[model samples]
Target: MAKKLELGDPAPQFDLREDGGGTLSLASFAGKKLVLYFYPKDDTSGCTMEAIDFNRLLPQFTRAKTAIVGVSPDSCASHEKFKAKHELGLTLLSDETKKMLEAYGVWIEKSMYGRKYMGVERSTFLIGPDGRIARAWRKVKVPGHAEEALAAAKSL
Candidate 1:
């Protein structure tokens, strides 16, 4: 069982390697609003749409003082290829061990086409500058989702 984080709860600290190189930690993003999103897999339809949308809105997010990060149980190599193929400018963290996914409660049992499996549930968390969860979206639908999150971040 995973401990689900809630509004006002402190975001879990993570220190993971990024796709291009070097490490990323939640503590390192203390002063900036963080958009931490978890998806089932890379290169999939929904995930790709979500990433592309975010990538397209990267400028707005940056102007709003938010840093976006996508996480999946994929390796650095895979993330690198995905970013290159899509021209993504945001950070993609490799959660190959699922530690951060579990901590954020995005890793869950999912069912599709009458088949069951455990994987990351498409979710996004907006961490305020104070390191607390200001907003959360679970089982997020990709269309217009990134825009919605950006609007919310601007308000914060």
Candidate 2:
């Protein structure tokens, strides 16, 4: 398992296929702050709400100079459908290989009704323009999360 990241740790690097037929990488946001959120799957209840909340707060995040991006272990096609279905205005990245997920330490053992499995633990990382993590929220609750992240970004 990768070591848990802490404040000031360099954010993990990633280069993945985005939903809308393009690649997105950590380097693409160079000299800009980034809000990197990880969700378990696309089109699920909690995931959908999280996406919508982030989308609704996109303009606020942009005003803070933070670009919001969602990542999941779903395919690009799945992300595309989810985005269209929800009218989400955020960039969704496909981490089908689970490399980026693991690197960020969001992929882990989960228990649901006595069934143990590996999945993403909803999390968010606020990366500063200098490529270091400014703040992180692990096992995030959907409600007010986007707003909280934005507040942190703005204060930074």
Candidate 3:
């Protein structure tokens, strides 16, 4: 596993297929802060709630000059359905190969019910306009996460 990224580290760059079409890249977010969140799957309870929370607070994030993008191993088609079902406003990117996930150090070994497996650890990164990580939250709790992220973005 790659070392966990720390504050001030350059955020990993990514170019991925986004839901509803088109590509999203780290360069596209230049001159603006980014909230890059990783979730294990689409449409799962925690993932859905996290997306909803980010969607709900999207306007605030926009006002803060921050853009939010959610990443998951789900396909672009799956992302589309999930976004539509939840009426999500933020971008959802597919990382089917998990390259970006590994680059960001969020794809990790996880244990549930005494069983170990590889999965995306629910994580969030705040990347400043200068492209350095401002903050990171690993093993994120869904509730109130968006708000906390927004607060950090606003401080940037």
> Which candidate has the top score in TM-score?
2
Best by lDDT: 2
For model 2, the superposed segments whose C-alpha errors exceed 4 Å read none
Give Cα distance to truth, residue 16, candidate 2, Å: 0.4
> Against the correct fold, how does model 2 do in TM-score?
0.98
Give the CA lDDT, 0 to 100, for residue 146 in model 1: 98
Better of 1 and 2 by lDDT: 2
Enumerate residue pairs that collide in model 2: none
| Tens digit of per-residue lDDT, candidate 1, span 5-79 | 889999999999999999999998988999999988789899999999999999999999999999999999999
State the lDDT of candidate 3 residue by residue for 54-102, as single tens digits. Answer: 9999999999999999999999999989988888888999999999999
Of candidate 1, the 10-residue stretch with the lowest lDDT total is 1-10
Q: Which candidate order results from sorting by lDDT in descending order?
A: 2, 3, 1
Ranking by TM-score: 2, 3, 1
Please give the RMSD to the true structure for each candidate, in Å.
0.8, 0.6, 0.7
